[model samples]
Target chain A: MPDVLAEALEQVQREVDGAFDAFLPVPEDTRARLVEAMRYSVIGGGKRVRPLLVCATAQLFGVTRQAAVNAGCAVEAIHAYSLIHDDLPCMDDDEMRHGKPTLHKAYDEATAVLAGDCLHALAFDILTMSDTSNDPFVRAELVAALSRASGHEGMAGGQMMDIVSDEQEYDLQQVTRLQQLKTGALLAASVEMGAILGRVPPEGRTHLRAYARDIGLAFQIADDLLDVEGDEEKAGKALRKDEGQGKQTFVTLMGRDAARAQAEILVEQAGQHLASHGADATLLVELARFIVKRDH
Target chain B: MPDVLAEALEQVQREVDGAFDAFLPVPEDTRARLVEAMRYSVIGGGKRVRPLLVCATAQLFGVTRQAAVNAGCAVEAIHAYSLIHDDLPCMDDDEMRHGKPTLHKAYDEATAVLAGDCLHALAFDILTMSDTSNDPFVRAELVAALSRASGHEGMAGGQMMDIVSDEQEYDLQQVTRLQQLKTGALLAASVEMGAILGRVPPEGRTHLRAYARDIGLAFQIADDLLDVEGDEEKAGKALRKDEGQGKQTFVTLMGRDAARAQAEILVEQAGQHLASHGADATLLVELARFIVKRDH
Candidate 1:
């Protein structure tokens, strides 16, 4: 199962990197700089979770793997931009991301900021420019979906909630709702984009969304768990920064043991969603486990 | 003619502000803050040159005025974001904009930077979401045109070039090319978006592009001329900061007298484009005169 997930991840990464590298505008100096910032933030590091979800969900409907690649690239671009901005001085204020200096720390803050902005715009640009999509309506739908996921109702809004609610206690339901918007929206978008490409049935779309939502929550919980007990070096940054910042995490709200148990249950539920889809979702099931069970 | 232009400008302000106010998202405090940054940068009082151009061009082809309002807002959003980012510490490092502290100064640098990014994305959001344009293909074209205008080949790329070439002795041609991509690209996009909304003829689009390009250069040159002899209070900025920074402008590359002469010629050429369009271009002709002759 782990081998299948690994193979899917590798394929998604190769295709996404190649497609992005090919599509980036060329020969202009400033464009080169923009592209470099994009490349620095995206290539050769971090788990390709979003892109893998796109590929796996498409495969569940027997869609051609090629069909998910562009959508995968689009989601990754959004994810990359989020990470870059999240690490900025005003946002998360982290110096290192994925074991290296954040883009702002590596380059200047303005470049990091502009690079993130360009990448966000470029995600929409790539979706709109996709020749393979064929249907303008589908393309428009994809653009609208991704924009909603990135905008006020989704990631940005969620980040704001997180900032305002830092160090504050909240009930499980409130915490869950916040995580659903912040982390789950994009994860949900990844699966939906793949389903859109696969032309999945409405029922299947609903099931897959639930699956994504569960796994997304589990992923965040697992991250909080890791921060509590994981190695600082292996975790890529200081392991206890969240607690240091008084950020409310699953571990903070619930005990470490309860959070771990909850994450395991969520992962099981995610697997059950894929079970009905059979061998088509074998990689997806493995991904769910890996997402919650991985050390780093 | 000037009275007509003034009335149109007044109408545009009311409509644009109303549309923007209505479309703003709710319930998300951070997103609202981002929107506030956008509204601050956009609605806070500057010459609405780009939005005016978009509206005037749409009017020239008998498009409904409401159709122009959304595009006007979108163009202003892009323009506002550019100003916010340009005034950042890493960019121009300006402390003031529109007689107020720059966005970075008003907010923190990171929020200001993120605000600019969000505003740029929001521009496309507004464009695609506009109800006036029912055609997806037309919306796609508008997105593409604006992206090209704002992306590496457009304003942002032009800005990078300007930053790199600052204080260097560039000739008049180089300066013109830089300004065209930076200032002129958005100006051209405004006109093109108007043409698309109006569903204008190909020849009409060409003429509008030509007119916009000329006016764009003339606009920059007039700015250079103003910087040489303008009032600081009215301009809302130090009068000679461009010269003080050793930046290359039309006045710096060519003599001030020559720059003024060139602006007049470009304005005349721009008016000639309007002439070819006949009575339809009456408002645009007046706009050209106002742009060249305005103090701020």
Candidate 2:
């Protein structure tokens, strides 16, 4: 685990945080409070996993640092917005996230809603900005990919399914579909958008996408497993709430041993998709392994 | 009153409707219900005033009909999303819109939220699509214009101001700023987007923006006047809602006669901004007049 890839990840995390701070509205703006809420929701939180995926995937093709960071910021913004809304009283109703009070508690419900919304808009704004890429086509493609991943046909729709399922029951297939849209869509988009930033043609991106698909499911399975067995201090949030909430998850449905085994297999399969990319994909492959083995 | 301009309005309205239907997710999709709620919130409703502004403004620059329609649809989707979110119980708490139950009333709060979010995503989706323009720069500019108009510094920030205004009081300037962001920003962006579609340079767009600013205020005044004087049946929803909520508006602050006079002056000023464009601006001028003269 102590490898060049791990060191690269630590560096990528700092770069991603800097990009977020640069893109977010400053505290001096007249509408500073709203921007403040946006910063609260986006900055000083998360594993920066999506950004890592973006940078790692982009590295495979020698994409420009700015282009990779720009797309990384876009996807990370989407991830942050989803988390803000997901913590709303009407949604998951969690009071704490990443060891801090959720945005709504720190500000207010309306600000939380608006902040999430603004973050969502900011993602597109950053992607479409000139700094993201010189080519307009790349910008448009990034918007299309990110929007589809984060929108109703994707994350928002999956959220609806998640909320609905709380009052009903979902089989393994239904929950899988929900998770794919809920978490996997954005995760896959991070990789897809990175490929786009690097100008990877659709034909060439097939294996990368295959890699993303495998990692997406494995990431969720790992998340479910963490909720069951991980330490709260390391996770920075409540664990085992999935069971307490009566929500069905991979670990609950598949049994802990079976789910863990499945995640390991998926990680192996994810690596296989990078077989043709040689050593260039070392970071991405290592990322898949990290998802399964990380304490958080 | 019955002129070619009015006839063009009807045509533009139909085109916008068709574009919305075409962009919305198909009914046969597994996520059809979310799309249905989105469609229900967007289609067969309202005056399509924003789209008309888009098309008419684009026409002034000889922009392609398809290009104009694409941008028009993008603006309409934002307006619809704003309205859906504005009507949420935590916001305005309206039960009906355009003579039908609000998205939440018909579906549920979660669906309403997701539908609003989806519509917002769809706006960007439509804007970045190749059909909007072959030139990626134009598409990128469109995304930038639309996102800034719809984001924190624009619509969402205005909404936050509005919700907070319920707990506090705002002076004329503050309320004007609020309205400008909430309503005027999108209205201004409609005209700006049309200009972008037409490849009008920033310097050339100043007057068109002035026209939009004037019309944006006039449109709000007319709306307030309608709340005071118009019939609910024609308006397709409740009237006098502003007064019922004790919300301050142009009509309330300026008094009815002064507000009406201000609207007339503003509309005339709006028309004057387009005077340099000559007969090509006829439709836009007529639209400015129509905004104030219409009962609903």
| Candidate 1 residue lDDT tens string, B1-296 | 47888898887877777776776644444345666766677664676777788888888778777777888888888888888878877778888778888887886775676667666767777777748577777676677678778876678767766876763566778788889988899999999999988887567588788999999999899988898989878888757977788888899888988888889999899989778778778888888888878887
Q: How high a TM-score does candidate 1 get?
A: 0.92
Considering just chain B, what TM-score does every model have?
Answer: 0.95, 0.96
* Candidate 1: pairs in clash: none
* TM-score of the second chain of model 1 compared to its true counterpart: 0.95
For A1-296, candidate 2 gives per-residue lDDT tens digits of 75876787778778888888887746443467888889887777888889889988988889988889888888988888888878877767778889898888898876887888899899999998888998988998999999988888788878877776767677889889988988889999999999999899999899988988889999999999999899998887768888888998898889999999999999999999998988888888888999899998
Give the DockQ (C-alpha) for candidate 2: 0.65
Off by over 4 Å in 1: A25-31, A61-67, A166-171, A199-204, B25-32, B167-169, B200-204
TM-score of each: 0.92, 0.94
Off by over 4 Å in 2: A1-6, A27-30, A167-169, A244-246, B1-6, B27-30, B239-241, B244-247
| Candidate No. with top DockQ | 2
- Determine which window of 10 residues in candidate 2 chain B has minimal summed lDDT: B24-33
lDDT of 1 at B83: 86
